[model samples]
Target: MSTTALPDIRAARDERVVGALALALAASLVVQNAAVAWAAAPSYAAPMTEVLAFHAEHRGAVAIAVGLEALNLPLLLGFLAGLRGLVEQRGGAGAVWSRLALAAGAVLSAAFGLYAVLWIGTVLVADGLTGPTPLLELVWQLHAAAFAFVLSALGTTLVAAALTTHAGRLTAPWQRWLGLVGGGLMLAAGAASLPIADGSSLLFVGMPGYAAWLVWLLATGVRLVRRAA
Candidate 1:
């Protein structure tokens, strides 16, 4: 007698596996944020020269930060995949948002990658690139601008995904609300970053937005693990 074909290995559902991946995504993001903190990236108030000096002195650390961020992109993509799959199952008007969220997530990640590349270049050439190179300044400004654009897209993703998932009881009440707030903050930060890429006070809004994202990611990851358990 012929044996039945084994279930498709790739298609197999293992709650723990998915849950762990989700948690890993959260941890990766935490580390990425921490790397930025470790680098002590200069704020808008600091003169560009000081910023350049700081990066020059901390080239090694900045490189490490870039590596850490590069790692986060894959982790984030995986997490978003899980989320998109879950939300897709709950077909409705809200489901449309899930689709949008998936697209937006891709765009957001790409924007971040661009920022990482430019930052690495800026740090690596700090020694050779002399004072007030307009090209360098332009790249720096564009990187910030790209982040602003992507952050708004990210906010759209989060908001849409949160609304869709809540409809299907994928998230708790508080988490759902928190996700909305987080999304709103991200959108606001993006708007602020759009016109104020010069590293001004308004860019500080992105800090809270970034914090909100961390909180949501951790909370969502924990909830997934709990539910899977």
Candidate 2:
């Protein structure tokens, strides 16, 4: 490794940076839950719930969670860039795969980012219309984008593990296993929504599962960075 590369690895391992990133991700997760709550709350409940129901009745309201989901994209892109630096510095044969992982990460991020923007725009345009669930409008495409994000994240982590040297190893089997389980939970959450005709019922599983996955990702990333340091 080049003398300069040491600092780059060390930066990737920085405790404070990692912690801040975790907080950011956690906040995004919070927004995701808020979106779900906004959807699931009854229309005749208290002031807060009623307000949420009002928003839920509109397309713009659904955009809130999508906006939160987009927030992860830029941060993930930066994380992948850091990983790329570390992989290149190591000059390992796994570097090729690491690069591929980074590409996957970028693709995943971009896909979600675009989803967020497009749907938010759709919501804004269709704000007060009492028509069919705009969700069903691009349902399959949105689901595919979401699935790609989950799978790409898993692929990225696997390649990161493969590329890390002994000195750079920042993850353990427990963490890896938790990640696998988290991904599975997210998949289940998505699948569970398929049969639910009610938007509220679908939000119950899908929203919380997504939040759980984000929390897991944030926590694991922090642990790995701290361990590396």
Candidate 3:
């Protein structure tokens, strides 16, 4: 290929990466939501025993959902790489914001990955465990704490990405607004979880925030796919 053709090939490859990342993220969201909702898994607010019982009975479904979520880890990394390249191409504050988004996404992905593993561990032992529900409760609290950090990082990633895209005229005005709102909601959810011991605190806004994020992921994925096409 000629020198001129190389850039086109590179650009196409990058677009494909973004498209692939979008699909992975969308699939992860769908599977995670379906597994939890269909299995009727207990929320963190539920009693320890209730939560344990649900998991004990529906371990297979829970595992499948979380497995799908785990599949997003690599896709998230790909997204960061694609965003970084876009930022470098655009230059200016877009560059800085993209770095921020990349950093935030990296840590967010790690945190979420760990959160999934932790839940898997808890579910595995839920059925055969003896007394001392407090022990498991403490473990659950720690899991929620990790999730809070994860959400906070996700919020930062979304906001920075939105700013970068908007500045570069890469996305629609409404999409940018959605990013801002979605980011704020995720941040609020993280904040609501400050009292780690009281999972009920997350009921107010935290859950809704994550639900919005799920929607955002789906929409963002579709947009990326269309852009690639």
For lDDT, the strongest prediction is: 3
Q: lDDT by residue for model 2 over 15-106, one digit each (tens)?
A: 34544555576677677767757666332112333433344475455666776786777666666565555555455545665576577666
- RMSD (CA, angstroms), candidate 2: 6.5
Deviation in Å, model 2, residue 178 alpha carbon? 2.2
For every candidate in turn, the CA RMSD to the true structure comes to 3.8, 6.5, 2.4
Candidate 2 regions exceeding 4 Å error are 1-19, 41-63, 88-97, 133-167, 184-212, 224-229
Give the Cα lDDT of each candidate. Answer: 0.70, 0.52, 0.73
Tens-digit lDDT track for model 3 on 1-229? 6998887677656666675676677677777778788989766677887877777789888788778766777777777678678656545547877888888888888888878877876776676876437657776766777778777888888888787777765567776787888788788777766574366565346556566666666666666567657
lDDT of 2: 0.52
Instruction: Give one digit per residue, the lDDT tens place, for model 1 in 116-187.
Output: 887876776566655756666776677677767767877876787677667767668887787788788888
Scored by TM-score, the top model is 3
Deviation from native of the Cα of residue 113 in model 2, angstroms: 2.3
Q: What would you estimate as the lDDT of candidate 3? A: 0.73
Candidate 2 backbone collisions, by pair: none
Q: How many times do residue backbones clash in model 3?
A: 0
